[model samples]
Target: MTLLRHTSKEIKDRSALTINPAKTCQPVGAMYAALGIHGCLPHSHGSQGCCAYHRTMLTRHYKEPVYAGTSSFTEGASVFGGQANLLQAFQNIFEIYDPEVVAVHSTCLSETIGDDMPQIADKAVKEGKVPEGKVVVTASTPSYVGSHVTGFANMVQGMVKGLATKKDKKNGKINVIPGFVEPSDMGEIKRLCKLMDVPIILFPDTDGVLNGPLTGKHKMFPDGGVTVEELRDTANSMGTLALGEWGSSLAAKYLDSTHKVPCQILGLPLGLTATDSFIDALRKMAGKSVPAEISFERGQLVDVMKDYHQYLYRRKVALAGDPDQLIALTEFLVSLDMIPAHIVTGTPGKKFEERIREITKDVPYKVNVKVEGDMFMLHQWIKNDPVDLLIGNTYMKYIARDEDIPLVRHGLPILDRVGHQYFPTVGYKGGLRLLEKILDAILTRKDRDDPETSFELAL
Candidate 1:
């Protein structure tokens, strides 16, 4: 008997319900973004349970201890509004934790009750709850509104609105918003910039904060993240590069409108063409030529792809993740002559579906794509039309097991796996890693299913 035996191949309409959602709540993304700020403690302006769920999700995903303060709203606060709870939380967080910044985000409970976060934050500042030089930034992240990707965008924009200020003198630096990626990916983006000899200030940089090395002594705040000064100096930079439209464009647009910073929005650099675009953008913006080292890495990625073309060509793949990731991954799969048979993202955006279809338009087979869809739908598609490989988070494992397909975990809430927090999947180097994973999954399956007599000693 199969686990998903009850699932029907016939696709049905589902508007009011979502089964096994691919995305988490807003507060989780907000807390993750807040942690990217140096010495910043995220505060959830809602019930303690909400904060706990958010923290637990992030902790499991990153395999790190995530700290966050909660308003701890009781029945009384729920009816009367959570302003008092938020104010008290601010006072306690400052006095006890003593962080340099308190990043606050609203939840469904607080938002539904009509609590004004900015007003309460201002009151906290007026009452001296926040000490001198310490900042209190707030983002309206109602869990009912959007997915975690939206929450990340809101919090990043809030950070810019609250801290970034234009100075008379330019810093000759560029601002790079790396989007909602892993800490290792952020580190890779920074390394690429350094190789290009371009000065960049990457905000919400979790490279050192989330992926820190363990030591004998434990510290509440790690030696990573973009500093408060760096956030402020974003306004003085030459230009801004927003890596992903969903996770980073909001903050970049804010800076452009308020501080006259030029902004360019691009997709996440998941493969060859996208990486080239990123490097080209950096080269043009910083007035520098592409470094020989960077060119060599690109050549190596191309060479490897050519060498392994037989393994990846025309392979059918199913993908589910955030919109930004799906867009880039779909294009990459098409480039490798792989059919992206089924694609789904829980985030609601028509542009996501449109972009996916556009990428797969020239493919030989019809593609199944959905925006704001659930894992159940993806499983149904797989049951009706099976793919050779599955690329998604841990949730896809059940489908993989039932369908007998190879799995390549690549998105958020990757609870069962590690190394994504340490290794990148974004740059040219990351592209190589992704290619290696894909080939390994495909070839390993081939080895398993093929007869022993027909097996070759070497490729």
Candidate 2:
């Protein structure tokens, strides 16, 4: 409660100030996106600290080895230019690391100085620093302009632009942009695609790369990741499914415009309705039926909802996370007849604000929504209008404790939890798990607050 001493319950306009940001910087997202590409080395084209911080954060979140290269900018590079540093990095990376692709992303320093990565890359290739047949892609990811999600989208678009090729023949394969979701969520999506019998090409797949096994040796480029071949064939796919407009739509839109591959933007498959939409989209795109197995999974989730609706009905809640996650999570909470009294995201966009407003319009209680916002504002809202449950990343735990509210961890950087790393939260099974966690939090609170005389074992 006292973590932010300067914060107050009174909501005021502070045009330039942002505290406890819900989203991280851009280069981190770029690094994560690069991990999804097979034999692709993520190179940070800025100060070494930026790369170090990104690698640390990603490593902590996934509890796995995150391998990335850096331009290792110095004072001279910062004052003059980083082109020489990057060119040298390219030579060293190609010669030593020997990755098939180098996914380069810019930082605040490079972008501020207007470093032309493309030109530098071209020079490197011409100077014979870049090996033939190897690839070098770049994304303009200034930390000042957009959040990590935007960086992820930009890097993915860069990957497509650099690697995807239009062939004469069209393949039945469907391209899936999984967005900035967990490795587990990516794996779950692949599972759902397989069950639907859809020949899908999921880009930036960090399945085994980010969530790899405890092998004796560490692989710089993990076994998991969309291969170069897969990326090349993406342009020849029948269509593309981009989940989460904020984190994925840009790349999908780019692919559509450039390659004539039609694109459909869908929310992350979280709740029953969202999952249904995803399944329906798959069915239509694949020209096939939803397999009975998938239906059974849906049925199981519905069964859980039916059994637990009483526990969750009309429960007031507060939520904070990325835009795509907030949208899907809000929808899921609303489906349970839960009041998402407060919602916030640090990622700035009119679209995010509009979507949130549109979602909460029908709610009985007033919903406090903010974009380009901070956690301090969310905490102030919670202080003013206390909620029964707080749902967000582990950062919300501080507020939950001070307010004595139950909390369900449901977003990125879940530093303290284990399941968010390995368990699925994107499909029917994911819905079931979400329902279970919410119920567990609510009921545990109920049990803790109930009078001793009125406490019933069954209830």
Candidate 3:
């Protein structure tokens, strides 16, 4: 029997349960965000198992070694609170790892016990667990609450609150929070900004940290990531451009409110429209015209879209991923005249559904959209009304195989494939890569299904 053979074609209303959830726990996202900081150690205030699982998830996804500390909560610590364990963790992390910053995030156990992260972190400092010039930041990321996307946002907000401070004068630079994208995407964003000659401070930038070269020597803290100085100087930047609403907005809003740094919250630059908005925002903020190089890249992407219209037009696609990425992707699909038949995200937000509906309102067919939904529901939808292409993480492959649909892995936890950490899916060039992938999937399917006599060697 197939993996999804039990999936019913009749979609039933489900609440209070999520099978094969589209999102992971919060600690994973927190750990990923913390790794974007230079010389930083992510500490989990919960069971050792939780920390290990979080590390393993990231390590598998990025195909790199991931290091994190845990409170090692036993039965006793779980009831009496893990405060002692956390303080000792701080002492050991500072003494052993010697990281510049210790980013502490809470798990389900710690959050359920109502442990106060701020108080414990302060206690660690008072007890000299944190050495002089070293910093400690804390974020509450309970698994029972929102998904990993929420945890990412919370940790970013923690970074801003703990480090950012206003200076005497503006630095005439921009602060960019790249959201929960791959290191390649972050690098692409930097490249676009550099092309426009705009100075930007991108925090939690994991470009070099996660996607380091295969040198003979191994360094615990790779020489990538945003330095402590840059994070502190974010307040002095002239403005801020937050990339994703869920992952980057909290930190930007905090900076705007606390330090008077003006911010513009935009979607992740995944496809053409989103990239255009990002470039335009950069152009306006920097008071510079759109450079010819960027214009040329945009033209290339447009040319390809026009050239391949026949292959992509009116092909139905089903998507499951984070809200920000899905929004931009949905818009991109619509621009290609492809129908987003069904879309689901585990993150809870009515606005996501509303925005998706608005984007696909003019499509020929009615779209099925859901927030706080699971993959099981998506499979059910696909069973009832099938799609030609499926886009999401590696987990979606099961549904793709069982339903005989082509899959394009695009989001987090893509363990079965590589190159996402090296090749971007954002910006104009990134859009070209994405278009190529979509075309490849569609054409490959056609080659597999079409008769030999009808198969064209030129297409």
| Per-model C-alpha RMSD | 0.9, 1.3, 0.9
lDDT of 2: 0.90
Stretches of candidate 2 exceeding 4 Å from the true structure = 1-6
lDDT of 3 at 283: 90
What's the C-alpha lDDT at position 78 in model 2? 92
- What TM-score, to 2 decimals, does candidate 1 have? 0.99
Minimum summed lDDT over a 10-residue window in model 1 is located at 1-10
Report lDDT (CA) for all predictions.
0.92, 0.90, 0.93
Where's the lowest-lDDT run of ten residues in candidate 3?
11-20
**Alpha carbon lDDT of residue 418, candidate 2?**
80
lDDT per residue for candidate 3 within 302-402, as digits (tens), equals: 99999999999999999999999999899999999999999999988789999999999899999999899889999999988999999999999999999
TM-score of each: 0.99, 0.98, 0.99
| Reference-based TM-score, model 2 | 0.98
lDDT leader: 3
Residue pairs clashing in model 3 are none
